[model samples]
Target: MTTILLLASLATLGYAAWYLILCSVSPWERCRRCHGARSHRTAIGTRRDCPRCDGTGIRVRIGRRLLDYIRTEYRAGSQ
Candidate 1:
């Protein structure tokens, strides 16, 4: 049981690292709700830019931001 748990934890960590790396390299993805339309229908029957994306139809790559932050911190630490 302990061995299994250890393997599971390691797997989770590996997956997290892979996902962060992918996010660091991947482009911004479209907002799911707007499907890249950059707008959505409001309750008043008017269209408005998606609040999540501000009508740009894209969001910042969280992984990339995280990677940049880590890099900055490491540089500061090294200096």
Candidate 2:
């Protein structure tokens, strides 16, 4: 039981770390106009309005709910 739980925990931690990395590197991170630029010229697919620099040719994306699931998992583990 302990080994199983340990392996599961390790897997979860690895997944969480990967998720965090993806989120942090996601083009849609906090609407930054940097390398991870959102594919769309406009925020048509996103729920929020396009970032301010949209008109000026700035690609930005805000990651929505990326960490929410991981956070939920972490919270659940505590219980």
Candidate 3:
């Protein structure tokens, strides 16, 4: 039981570290809706910019957004 708990905790820690590094290195990821094409095709074959990413083809990672929010909150609290 203890071994399983230790392993789970270690896995969680490793994933967190990896995600932090990822957010630091590449905070943006391809938009799921546009698949990095920046636009989507309508049923009639017309193309429109992706609404989610605003045609940027990428969006900020959730982890990075969370980090930014936390940093902003900390700064506001400190001041």
The candidate scoring highest on lDDT is 3
lDDT of 2 by residue, 19-55 (tens): 6677667644333442234333444654333455443
Name the lDDT of candidate 1.
Answer: 0.88
Model 3: CA > 4 A from native: none
Tell me the TM-score of each prediction against the true structure. Answer: 0.74, 0.37, 0.93
| Model 2, backbone clash pairs (residues 3+ apart or across chains), number | 3
1-79 per-residue lDDT for model 1 (tens digits): 9999999999999999898878867758878879889999999999999999989998877777777899999999999
TM-score of 3: 0.93
Clashing pairs in 2: 27-36, 28-61, 28-63
C-alpha-based local distance difference test score of model 2: 0.56
Higher-scoring candidate on TM-score, 1 or 3: 3
Which candidate would rank higher by lDDT, 1 or 2?
1
Report lDDT (CA) for all predictions: 0.88, 0.56, 0.97
Which candidate tops TM-score? 3
